[model samples]
Target: MNPPEPAHTPQPDVVAAMRGDLADWRQWLARVIVLAYAAAAGLSVVAFSKLCDLAQQGFASVLAFNPWTPLVWTSACTAGVVWLTRRFAPAAAGSGIPQVMATLDPAVPAEARRAFVSLRLSVMKAVLTAGSLLGGLASGREGPSVQIAAGVMQHARRWLPPHPGISEHGLLVAGGAAGIAAAFNAPLAGVMFAIEELASRLEQRSSGLIIAAIVLSGLMGVSFFGNATYFGTIEVPTLRYSMWWPALLLVLATGGLGGVFARLLHASITGQGDRLGRWRAAHPVAFAAACGLAAGAIGIASHGASFGSGYGYTRGLLQGHVDVPLLYVTLRVVATWLAVWSGVPGGIFAPCLAIGAGVGHDVAVLCGAQADASALIALGMAAFLAAVTQAPMTSFIIVMEMVGGHAMVLSLMAAALGASLVSRWIARPLYAALAQAIIARGRLAPAVAAPSR
Candidate 1:
């Protein structure tokens, strides 16, 4: 009892000890979060591979049909997607990136805030993405995959025990990075992407968690998918000093083109969704049928070059087996742009890859540099992704991991950095800017602002 005297006795050591314990707990929590992100990332990879297999099987089935049958199938699928979008969730249309940006933007209002984790959006996105794949749209599944993974993680937060001061935005970034890692089987790229593209801020503390999550996700993906490269093994080429000038030129041109494409895509798809909504409301089945018919016609004319994720075409470009001329690349580019702009549910990521490969192929042939087509294709990929997403480091690292080996690192770095700079000069970051526009237009209400860190 006598010892209980002096309630205000000095205890600097106790405070210091408490602070040390808190720091240790924070580190432990950070590790756990990273582990969770890795698991999610691994699942994302499995999901992407399954989707790819399904898409491939679907394409094979359609190809087995008579030429006319493909046309009919294309029309039917496109029409069904349009009807479903009009009926169920119009927000599910397009690349899904813009919607994601809108969802993440802090300026969005509370009541008007669309549920990022809504099961409805998930189901609709899956359905629309499958439809786009089947309907011969030139899109990828990565964007939808990103949305699905983000939504899943958002919903998962409810069950997670509350952490004293954890940020949901960080979780969302982790999920998105995992999604990309899973999709491409590239963990490092995903980590960089989380910081450069998704996270508005770049700092060691914030990046530490995201990086851990990305690595974990990538590891998980490899565990499930057998640690194979996304595009198989790539043959690295010898670099020559003479080729630098041509590579630089290719980077600049492709980067500028990517910026233009980004601008056009945003303008065409954003407010235009409402117009399609009105059209569908007035003539649902017929409008759907017309869209399907147009898709079929394009597919047939392009001899199926315009279908799916453009993987076949990308492969062809990589292998130096593109059967068509440069004009075909242009056609495919326009087709992809229009297909997505017209409200097809898919992603531009893969299509951009295809476009980049085509551009690289054409450039390589024109320059008469007997460089390995695959190397050129890889460079093109980095440049195009950098230009479109304005995430050069992410694009460069992702391509390197996807392609494997270090022979082409210098080329990739130069091209990606150049392309990113060129694109940035031409346009604002595509998704972030789009999110801001949506907020400005009152389409989405602002949310509680989170410090980017």
Candidate 2:
């Protein structure tokens, strides 16, 4: 009893102990904050889907009332959006993924945060992305979704009564994952993508928060979408033992091609940016207009095949309904790459998936073995995504969720790993290269320090 009393007397101040406990509690609370935001993000996806559906319906109605009416309106809207972006928020041009990466870069200055997250920039992104969709641009919603979600989270953080003491990088990563989860209705993939592709410095501790946020967001998304699969139910055919070798060959071919596409996109986008800066110094509007006109022409030629996220087209590819020839796939790849490269406010996520599916379809036909076409499409998706993004695990998870085929996990994993390895050997990571280009251009100030906790 005397020894116990002496031990108790030797303990540190009670207040200090309480303070330490309070700090730990605050950290836990902060992590919960990210998950809560993720839930909100999932809700946002459902909302966005509704908005898109309404927009499409409205356009159809307007077209019915007066044939060619919506196209005219869409053209005007596109031009207006281009003008707004050129005049007010040039940085909002293109996919905004690089912008998010720029913000998270430890080399960028904190003082420039306002410029990156400005209301004007956010508005411009919204308007342009909406206009692109209406005007039949070969773009996807995911990029604008990422930008808008990130802006929302950034502002939300500031609004907290006493802002959490976590770093902005954490919030940015969480926001991006939420955006992807909401956009694609694939929350696990979003979380894995953030960890594998976006995190400036990955760690086990940070990964836990990202995973929690992604799961919450995904659940929220399912609530809105009624748990429907994004790509519908794909009936994957069981692989015959003899088909394994051919499947491997398909994976290698697509992986190599995907790597080439990623490299080409990186070169064109950055090169065009540089050339436009010099050639169109006083005519940003003209540059944007040219991009819009090219997009419109491409849309008309492709007969809307390459437009939007290619969601319908992707489904068609998987179902073998599109009859998309290799040439069509090539054309789509080039058009989508150009649309994004020209600084249109859109995403490459859907387009890339479609490309991968198309490539897979072609490979399946080439194999001439009556393989499961849907399964081949799924493998193509994982392989091409891994090649482009260099995130094999994320790509694998995303295809699995999109197709809802856990049975094909082994095939997907093999394709993804093989593709990722081939792509890494062939080309640099896409986002990293994009980030470097942004920094080299001096469009963003260098990061001053890593965000502090």
Q: Using lDDT as the measure, which candidate wins?
A: 2
Candidate 1's TM-score: 0.84
Error of 2 at 414 (Å): 1.7
| Candidate 1 lDDT by residue in tens digits, 1-453 | 456656676656987888886776655664565566457545754665576568757866877767666578877777777778767876677666666666655555434434543445766777678777766666788777667666555544444445623455666677677777777778887777777767667444556766666677777777777677667667776776877776877898889998888777666555456776577556866765776677667767877776677777777666666665436667677777756755667787888887787778777777886465678778998899888878788888877877674677888988988888888877878777766665666555444433121
Q: Could you give candidate 2's per-residue lDDT for residues 172-193 as a string of tens digits? A: 7777677777777788777776
**lDDT computed for candidate 1:** 0.70
TM-score of structure candidate 2: 0.84
Per-candidate TM-score against the hidden true structure: 0.84, 0.84
Give candidate 1's error at residue 64 in angstroms: 2.4
User: Backbone clashes in each candidate structure, one number apiece?
Assistant: 11, 7
